[model samples]
Target: MTKPVGMEVAVAAAEAVALCNIDVAACYPITPNTHIAEHLADIIADGRIDAEYITVESEHSALSAVMGASGTGARTFTATSSQGLMYMHEILPITPAMRLPVVMGLGNRAVSGPINIWNDHSDIIMQRDSGWLSIFADNGQEAVDMFIQAFKIAEHPDVLLPINVNMDGFQLTHVVEPIVFPTQAQVNKFLPPYKPFASLHPDHPLSMGTLGLPEIYTEAVKARDVATVNAKKVIVQIWQEWEKQFGRKYEPVMTYKTAGAEILILTMGSMGETAEVAVDALRKKGVKVGLLKLKLWRPFPFDEIRKAVRGAKTLVVTDRALSYGGPGGPVCSEIRAALYDQPNRPEIVNYIIGLGGRDVRVEDFMKMIEGAPKAKKSGDAYQIYGVRE
Candidate 1:
């Protein structure tokens, strides 16, 4: 399978982390993730890819030089977006409580004020609790297969978090598709090299970002929320072994025909491809509707979004970014808290739509799925969509 046509899903995400043999990149550039660190510093200056790029300056020293070259184990990676991910919001909780499986590429932007660039997700939605394993890609072949399955579920020794691979601004990083660049012998028989169960050893040296009080700081933040809820079962067993070596099955939450739908839209990056042509033109004008697509926003799948809006009667969602006064934004307040304990739950409708890079076309998701029956019975928490005076 070969198909790297006109490239630039940020150089097919630095050629899929140099075919997953990454060994320290530590970058510093933010755009659309600065053309994926300028095409991985020209594939580490044409040595063909041995790694060790490290051109740091600021996104907090490019995540403090990939948390000090992934704490001397080194299989790191980097890329940023929007105010350089809020200027690395204080080492994004010290690279997953110093676990350091640092694989990033969050080119989704739109987090300025009164001054704008493009796309949105409020810069990885303010690092949603900074444990970082946020994924969200809706194009460019799921942002080069979620940066190679977010470094095999963030260096999975039972998930050592710190994986963020969003894609949006300039729509999937200067949008050019037909990806499939997998074979470096199938990404070296599916990503191997990183073997640091625990690192930084000048002969057994440790002591990283310490200072835990309050009786071991609530068991070190409950072992980083049980390693981010055991990364939802180790990201479904590394996405079922990356769908048996890249057949692709990415469903940390994705649905299309919402079962027996009576309308369900919801969305994520690239407006879920303009809500998949507004769910096939409102299902060829018959309009039963269905969509949902949120490829993992933090550890918030919420049981596959409560079984894809459980027999929907109206779902909607659709936020781009806006939580200022706070009503509906961060993925429609996590899809209204995953259907607020659904007992026949449906009637949800947020809709803030395509800010800054605003042009959510396809007839603005087919006039918001043909007004989803009066904006889901108008119990509004939102409904902004291409706002004006």
Candidate 2:
């Protein structure tokens, strides 16, 4: 085990990528996410990590370059945030469709309206169905740990898919924390050298990215979807192995003090940490509330989420992203769908908060939990929290 060292989360992530010994990195500058790319570029330039770092003109090109490099059997990486992620949107679904295991770091930021750069899940959640395996890190250590797990999970023989580790933009990315660095040998044992399932080469004479004709396109899409769904098994296996080796456990849906609680708050990304604190404070006040943090985004973690809030009578889902004119927020919509058919499911409510760098304090969370029932009784499916009176 290596000693814990203090550093910015972005810096620690860059170091983790270096340890993985990726073959190439295509990057573009975006707020909050630029630091990770900058640090990686520095390490490569310093001759510390032997990898090709390409500074592309746009996020689209950044992902395109990695797609090409990854097709040639390279362990590829990229980093972006908000608009950069949206710019790369055209190429996101293609990665998993082609089964290229490219690992990316998504600096979670708010989508622009009046234009803002701050910590929010709108950027990543906007691309929820992008066919990539997504994970959220609560803190810097979890950030470090997940990056290592991501490469392994993405490249697993059964799960050849792209993965994204989403950390709160400035909240986690720029914030410094004590991170326990994984030893080089430990990483080597955990993540093996890249052995691609198929590579583009002259001798092989393989046709890569052939047109998906209408005749077989539906089947092609179905195959891609199935592959992603089945990847859950591999994700669980890899995380279990990681827990055995590192003594840090991870789950798709993690619960905090749910026992004997009648109300539960659901959260994603690093916001769960704040929600957990609120749960504790409310518990001390005899509020009988608990918290559930969702770590996995795609493949939706339906079973785990269902299990987490089984006994609760009410569910308040805190969403960092708004669905605008839709029923509720994106995550809340999914939760509703997941619990729709259950006979004894809790009355679910969604409260949208922390959009575009807004702060989510413990008191605010308590207010949401306390007010959701009344809001639900008013026939509103969701309520936006924290609007000025």
Candidate 3:
């Protein structure tokens, strides 16, 4: 086991990418995510890793360049957040449709019309149906471990889909924490060199992201959907391997203190850790409140979620992003859909919180849990937590 050392989470992400021995990194600077690319550039420049670092003028160009590099059989990486992710949306779906196994580090931030640079899942949620697998990191170790696992999952022959590893902007990104930087030998054992399923070559030319006619378009989309949904198998296999190598295990839906909890609050991203505090406090007062965290977002782990929330009477799901005019947050909506057919599903409560860097505390989680039953009985769909009167 490598000794733990204090490092910024973004730097550790760069280090994780370096350890994967990526061949190219296309980078453009953007708020909260710039450090990742900057550190990667430094890694390449300092000879810590052998990679061609391409500095692009915008996030669109950055991801486009990375996509092209991956098309050429190069293991590529890039980082972006908020508006940067939005700017790259045009090419986002193309990556997975072409089956390019590019990995990205997403500094999860709120997209802006008024321009705010803080932590939220809005940017990532907007790209949810873009055919990319999404994973959330709750802390520094998770950020590092998931990135290392992502390349393996994305490059696997059965998957060959791009993945975005999301770290909450400013919350997890800017924090300096003690993280275990595994040795090159350890990483090499965990992550084999990336092997592209297909490559763009002049000698062996292939068409990618081609126009689909009305008759073929639907089938092509179905093919991508099948590939993405099936990616969960590879994700699980990779996580299992990561566990064996590092003694750290990750699941699609992870739980804490749900043994006999009547009320459970579900969360995603870094908020899970904060909610743990409330879970502990509530358990102390003899309130059967537990916490459930969704680590994997894409291909929506339906069975795992259904299994995790089993036997709970009330489920309070907290989302960091809003759907605006919709029923509730993205997570709560998905959870409801997943549990729709269950014979004994809990009464789900949806809460939208922490948008545009809004602070949410342990007490807030407790209140949400306490208010869930009333919200359910009142026939309200969901409530925006901490909204001003």
Candidate 4:
């Protein structure tokens, strides 16, 4: 039986992982993400879930341990945030290259320099090309739901790759909401026991993660690239299956009031809800504005993006992370590139907002939308919202 209960998003995420019957959880303590690892430890300590919680020395070791466990065919899980994720940078690319289907819960936070701990997309954005299937959750419900769906998507025979379920640090992670949890039987039915395509066993001896010489290095990387792109099919299939059973539909690009609108506001992560409120207010005032929330970050969702912005004249793209020295933001740059060859593409106005846990209010969204027309052109530059003079 599925039950709805008010819970903190971090706890709810840990609960979702517990329901998946993961075999090993090796996570280090990091801000915003610590609660998840702590709760997982409690669950294992309480014997609620028969899983091994490996205590590691650092975030690097945390990922390394999970990799070894996953290589041994264990259903592995891990969680991290901010610098912790950066610490795992070396292992990030290796995991996908080795085709390990490890699932991780990323509490999205700002990367350090002056040392701040808060909500932002900078952390995850740093690993954009690491070849992990990244998905963002707009709220607590989506966070819980995506964690459960991640295993199925990653372990699919067609897509044996790692996945990162991203939720805003402090914004989505620490907040409490009414999250619906599927029953153990329901989870079991949806996600059967993970059957590894290959494993490290003594009897069936086979080499894994062997050195890639110069001759085959290009082909090796090409194979991984193709695999990442093709994983979209399995991801959608798993999402559809989840909807069929749980009644919550998910798509790569989730739209709100986009029909027949000439202007669209694009956002990712938890700010989508805030943008939705702005959209409703603008619509009430007879503005033809809509909201497009990106859920699937990697593999880029090119077709859905093209379809969503088809008739819009202007697209206001809000990015939480700034792409230094390059385009205004990573997402805005990608959106421009995706629509470059399209027939009638909209003018993109990029704004890097809510960096380092800055609050982005509904009125701020409204101001951005209202002021977008007068803002600089698509390639001119990006505006940093709410910066003090």
Tell me, by lDDT, which candidate is best: 4
lDDT of 4 by residue, 1-389 (tens): 45679999999999999999999999998998999999999999999999999999999999999999999999999999999999999999999999999999999999997688999999999999999999999999999999999999999889999999999999999998998889889999999888899899999999888999999999999999999999998898899999999999999999999998999999999999999999999999999999999999997999999999989999999999998899789999999999999989998899999999999999999999999988854356799989997
lDDT (tens digit, per residue) of candidate 3 on 1-389: 87899999999999989999999999887889989988999999999887899988988898899999998899999999999999999999889989999999999999996689998999999999899999999999999999999999999999999999999998999999889988889888888877777788999988766888999989998888999999998899888888888898899998999999998899899999999999999999999988899999997999999999999999999999888889789999999999999999998888899989999998888888888888888787778889998
| Sort order, TM-score high to low | 4, 2, 3, 1
Query: lDDT of each structure?
Result: 0.81, 0.91, 0.91, 0.94
Candidate 1: minimum summed lDDT over ten consecutive residues — where?
1-10
TM-score for candidate 3, please give it.
0.98
* Candidate 3: residue 53 Cα off by (Å): 0.8
Candidate 3, residue 172: the lDDT equals 93
Q: Clashing residue pairs, candidate 2?
A: none
What TM-score does prediction 4 earn? 0.99
Error of 3 at 11 (Å): 1.0
Which pairs in model 4 have colliding backbones?
none
- Residue 75's lDDT within candidate 3 is 95
Candidate 1 lDDT, tens digit per residue, 1-389? 67657677888888888888787787777777788888888988898978778777788887898888888888888888888889889889889897788998878888888668788777778778888888888888778877888888888888887888888878778878777777888777777767788788889988777888888988988888888887888887777888887778888778876667788887887678777877887787888888888888878878888877777777778878778788677788877777787788887778888777877888888888788678767776887876886
Off by over 4 Å in 2: none
lDDT of 2 at 27: 93
Measured on C-alpha atoms, candidate 2 has an lDDT of 0.91
